[model samples]
Structure formats: structure tokens, C-alpha cells
Target: MNKHSITLSFEINEPQLLLRDAIKHYGISKKALTSIKYEGGTILVNGEEKTVRHILTVGDKVTIIFPEEKSSEGLIAEKGDFPILFEDEHILIFSKEAGLSTIPSREHPHGTVANFVAGYFAESGLSSTVHIVTRLDKDTSGVICVAKHRHAHHLLSEMQKAGTISREYEAIVHGFIQQDSFVIDAPIGRKDGSIIERLISQEGKYAKTSVQVLNRFHLQGEELTHVRLQLHTGRTHQIRVHMMSIGHPLIGDDLYGGSQKFISRQALHARELNLKHPFSGETLKIISPFPKDMKDIIPTKTTK
Candidate 1:
């Protein structure tokens, strides 16, 4: 057996049904079934090879061996330092530092989190491709989720679509917000003629962000507020755009009209993530502490 191949065995408990039906009842997807049939996978009943049409009965043992996975070309493995928050056979969660891209792009074709993960998989002898469940911006630091296999990826994607996965972020905005808590309901669309900029527009898709003031302080005579934000929609630059729309752009977010006199990049961090396990159905809460640069901005008791 390949070390990376996932094998699941189940003892049938229901009445007579086709093996395919049993597999579907167990949450196996149609695409996975097709892969099992066409790819180098195997299905067995009572320790003997069987097809999907085989009749399944109570007390029958069904075993499924998933196909081997291969990393895509150009995803060169490169080792780097990354903090692991949680890991299991089905999932891997890690804290990503600011200034590192989550995945490679044409401009940045290497040295990303994906490349490092590929290297980790190779060193660990896991024959799996990189499947990022939650992606953060290149300049955003926070916890990110990754699936270990195609099946896990599919299940987690479903969870994301169903709105079962949630995230919380902390940021320092330019101006102090008077309101303690509020929601920004706006539409976000790409700025005209810019592939990287997003703005509030009437023709854009709906985006909502819940904001709460965590603390208020003055830095070098400039008013600033620390806020917690939760996204109801995952639009590109949603938080940055929404904060700017409310007249409190994140500090150092120059693209969104924030000043960069104090910090080099946006003062945003993915603080927490809440989701149910794809396989175990248990709630998982992962947290990342404030990075040194973000923490330094907060004033001490005497300064506040």
C-alpha cells in the first residue's frame, strides 16, 4: 500500500443496496467515485475485489482505496520556516507570516506557502498535492487551512460554500471610529482598469463586514482605533474596501487610501478561524497571536 493513499473500510449496517449507493451514503462524491473507477484505485467486498454494482448487505465489509495524488508541474518544492498550528491525516493548519504569498503567481513564481508545503509533503513521504482551503492575501498574516487529499478538499469546499466556515480578523484603522459595533453592508467590485484594486460600487456583488472597536489610542498625535472584523462574504479586498468606505482605512494600506508613515504594509491579521472537521464533524478553532509589528503599535497603559 502506498503511504499516501487513503483507504477507508466500512461495515454495512443498512439493508440491501448497491455498493455505489452505499458509498454515496457514506459521503463519497461522484467525482471521487469516477476516479476510483478509472484511476488506479480499488474497491473490495469481503476482502475480494468488487465493482460498484455489487449488491451490498448488512454485515458486509467494504473497503475503498483512493488514487495516488501528484503535485502539479512548476510547483517546485522549497523548504522554509512555517509555524504549524494543527495537523491530522485529513487537514493541516498553519500560521502564515505577513509579506508571503499564499500561492505562486506569474510575478511570484516561487517561495510561496504552497511551495513550502510541497517540500514538507515530500520530506514527510506524503504523495499529495497542495489544496488550500482558506487563502490569505500576500500581505496579510494569519492562520490558513490546507487539505491533505482531494476528498478532504472537496468536503471542506462544500463546508465553505454552506457558510459553515468562519474567520475573524483584527486591524488597526487610521481614524478612531465612534461606534463600538456596526456592520458595513456594501457592494464590492474591481476598480476601473485595475486588476488589483477593489472599491465600493453599485454594480458590485454584496459584501458585509461586522466591525467592533477593540481599543482606541493615539500614536504620535494621530488617532487610531483597533477593530475586529468578520466577513460575511469573501470578496477580494472586501475588508480593505469596506473599511475605507467607512472613513477608517487600515493603517499602512496605501492602496486603499491609508497612510504608510507608521507601518510598511496593511495592519491586518487573521486572528481566528472556526470550522467543523471534514471527517470527524468536530468544531475546530484555530488562533494566531498578534505579530510583533502589529503588537508594537498598541500603546502601553501609560501611553494610553
Candidate 2:
């Protein structure tokens, strides 16, 4: 077995949030809480192991070890040189390109954003305690935040659980977005018997996305629509499943059978992020444009 070690001392008002966010920096595929219990590592809080439900005080020390597992790709580590969108004392945001998983997966162990980010940290001598504020699908590209320190990680994460951060995405779906603006308010959950699947449900977790039609046009015998999606509640693939439920899956997202006509990859991009700066207590908004393919599909003629 291989072993890796990390140590952090922080004034934490919350421990569970801190641990959960800390694990994200490792890019573990499982949920953070699950990672803590199952990652085969000893986690000591101020030199003592504690449960996730434990209440923590300030001045607690955290020590963790990342379990050694074979890389899925079985390839030599590659830097990948993923681009950065914004950075501050508390957070670092990346413009995660499409076709890249946010973190490592079994089949795609390498070439993930997390792996690249991890390599970057090792080279730059930065803290390894990256905290993911939110998650996007592998095919979805956009702004992703990583906390630089454990304290800020906990604070920013608590703010997220309290619904302080706002995120938006840009997508080009398969059909005309006839409505000027509409809402996809629904619940989402896992599909039975599938480890990598999602569906809409009545008893599932609640989620909402406000979709605004930027333009609509016809291209090569199929309806193409440009849209902006605002997430009110984050759920696993909520937007993708919701859009497919409405009969207009994204152009390339066959996972939801989005569009068989033109798009082959899920046509989604994390375009904007709004949140209060953890250290400054000031609101920060970051915006990014859609990829070249999406931008080219825009209806310059302007048909709503």
C-alpha cells in the first residue's frame, strides 16, 4: 500500500463541512463524507478521530492521508495545463474544459481536472486542501472553485449550504426555445440499477433551473436554440435530466437523448458564478463565454 500525508490547523466553526471540502481537493470520486469513512485513511481532528456529526471548535488540527489506488488510465501523470478563470486568497476558479471529468473516475482515472489541479499544486508548492464549491458533469465545462485553505473552505462551504452562492450555465439545446423565459422546477434522483444515471422523481431531492432563451434558429434540418440556465437548487445532472424531461435534451447529450440531430456532446457550459467572497464578505460574480461550437450556433439573426 502507498501512503500520502497532509496536515492542517484551523479555527473551524464547522468540522463536517471542512472535512467534506478537504476531501474534494484529493479529487476522490465518492462523496466527501463517504471518502472520510471509506478512503482507508486515518483522519484526526486536533490529534483525535471524530465522527462527521461531531461539533468542532476553533484551533482544531486536522491530519489526513490519501489512500493509494491505481490510476484508472494507468498512464504517466500529465499536467494537462487546464486554464484558470479567477483566483484570490480564499478561492481558485478554473474554466474546466469540456470532455474532461471534474475528478477521477474508474475508467477515466487520468486527464481529469482534479488530477491536473493536484499536479499543479504539487509543482507550485500550494496547499492541497482544495474545496469544491459545486460540481458539474464531465461534459459540462465552466467555472469551478477550489478553496486555498481549510478555514476558508469551511466558511465558503457553509455559505453554499446556506444558499449564498449563485451559478448559471449556457447551453445550446436541440429544439427551439419558444418561451422567452421559463422555469424547470423539479426533483432529481438516481436511476435504479445504474451507478452513473439520473432521473426525475416526485420524492427525489428538490431542484430548480430558470431557463432564458437567448435565440432560436434552424440549422441543417434541426431546431437549434441558445439558452441561459440559472440553477436555483443543485442536484445531480438536474439540468440535463430536466431539459430532456421537457423533450429538448441538449444537442449532444444522448445520456438524456437530448438531440440526435446535430450535437454529439452535451451542449452545456458553466458560464457564470456569483458568490460572496469568503474572506472579504463581498459578493463576487464571474462570467465566461460559451465554447467555440456554442458561440458559432448563436442565432445572430435574433429569433426568439
Candidate 3:
């Protein structure tokens, strides 16, 4: 039993069920179950050790003790500034600002959301790896999630693959989209010569996006449309690519042929995230309002 082991307790409500059945009902992943079986983890009934095959009856108190993570390595915990939206022992959510990359890359070796989180964890005296569940592009400000440990990351990744994690983005595009709503079903692949740009192609991975226009405006003699988009598949630059394919690239998204006059970065913000808690099975909905730089694009009473 490590010092940071997680304990999950469940009260049996059914008449007769196996411990495994209860665990399944609780939405624990099979990979986690295997880890519990072999990684010094334990299952108990009331106070005694029990196996998954143990018969559970009404009011039986079942407990699972998960192994603790090993200490994180090779990370430089330099201090950074960001707002934490939600945090617990196993997870952290932050409102990352535009111009900040989610993780360190060759070009951005420091000053990323990961580095900021590393600094935060160091300040809090916690030893854990940076386990990001959702990633936002540099210049795309919004709500981002990170797991404090590897187990929570694994569970959240499973949820994402199952389409249980939902993300909504608000974007201001170049044109006034005539359709109130539409869906973009396209395959995306890296451009033939460019390493960073993604484009629609026949040989690419399948992707889908749903869009609904929120408001239309004529600002500074240019037409701009505020829209809400939902991603069915998480691909690199899915929204920008899809919108560009439809001749309405996001304002300030230079890579996608958008004009850079409105803002220095993409006129896109991750508006909301809906998902189940990795451990508690509770539904969590996190939101970030539209960034101030984008609000001027919206029509006011005078513009209307």
C-alpha cells in the first residue's frame, strides 16, 4: 500500500452480484482491473480481502485500493501563470490562454501548459507525471484537462475513444455562412509538403464536425459569422481545415487562409467540455466564456 494509493468504496444495492459485476457497473476500465489484480492493489469486503468472484449481497461494502504512481522524471518545473478551473487529487483542469501551447515541443521547449502544470504540482508538493487528456492548439484558448496520475489518464483516454467526452468550440469565421447549421464529414491528412498543415484528402483519417451559426454580423465592411462547432472526431486542425474547405476559414487563422486583421491568433475558443469523471462516474461540464478579443466581432445594438 503506497502512501498515495486511491480507495474507491461502493455500496451494493442489488440482491446478489459478483464483485466483478459491481466493478463493471462502476465503469472501471479492464486495463485498470488488470492493474489492480497484479500491481499490489487490493479488493476488500467490509474489512477482509476478497476476490472479484466473491458474491456481494445487499448493503455489502466493497472497496478497491489502487496502486500509486511512480514519481515523475525529466520535467523542469518552471513557474507559470494560468487559471485553474477545477482540480482534485487525480485530475486538473485549466483555462489556458491563447499563444500558449498545450505541451512542450521542439519549437516550444518551455512555457507550455504542461510546464505550468509541472510548476503547479511542484508548488503543491506532489510527485506525478504530466498526463494531458485533451490538447488545444497554440493560439486556441480554452478549457484543457490533465490527469494527475497515469491511471486517471488511461481511464479518460478510454472515455475519449468511446465518444463519451464532448467538446464545443466557438469560432468567428470570415464569411457569413448562409446555412444555420450543417455537418462536415471529411478525411484529413497532413499536407503533401508541409509538416504542420492538415488538409482534406482521400487517403486521410475520417473526421466529422457539426456547426451551428450563432450570429451574423457585418463588421468594418467585412462579413463575420459567430458559430458553435462540435467535433465528432479529434483530428489535428479539424475545425480549421473543415471550415477552410467550405471557404470560411477562421478569422486570424493564417495557416488556413484566414485574414490576420481581426486578431493575432485564431478566432477560436474551446467553449465547453462534457465528460464523465474518471473515478467518481459523475458528469462534469466545464466552460470558458468567449475571449475578450473576439467579442468585438459580435454585433451589438448599434451594429444591428
Q: Which candidate should be chosen as best, given lDDT against the real structure?
A: 1
At residue 202, candidate 2 shows an lDDT of 89
Q: Using TM-score as the measure, which candidate wins?
A: 1
Clashing pairs in 2: 249-258, 252-263
For each candidate, how many residue pairs have backbone atoms clashing (under 3 Å)? 0, 2, 0
lDDT of 1 by residue, 1-304 (tens): 6777988888998877899899887778999888888989899999999998899889999999999988756788989889999999999999999999999989888989999999998888888889999999989999999999988999888888788899999999988799999999999998899999999999999898999998899989999999999987789989999999989999999999999988999999999999989778788999998899999998875222
Of the pair 1 and 2, which is ahead by TM-score? 1
What alpha-carbon RMSD in Å does predicted model 3 have with respect to the real structure?
2.6
lDDT tens digits by residue: candidate 3, 137-248: 9999999999987668878888899999999999999978999999999999999999999999999999999999988888789998889999999999999999999999
lDDT per residue, candidate 2, 1-304, as tens digits?
2323333334455534655554445333354345446856556777787664455555566565433322223323448776787886557887887788777767777787777766676566553543567777888888888876545566677777788888989888877867889998889988999888899988889989999998888887777888889988888888898898898888889888866455557889999999988656677888765788767666568677
Query: With candidate 2 superimposed using the best TM-score fit, by how many Å does residue 46's alpha carbon deviate from the native?
Result: 22
Off by over 4 Å in 1: 302-304
Worst 10 residues of 2 by lDDT: 67-76
- Give the TM-score ranking, best first: 1, 3, 2
Candidate 3 at residue 142, lDDT? 91
lDDT of 3 at 271: 88
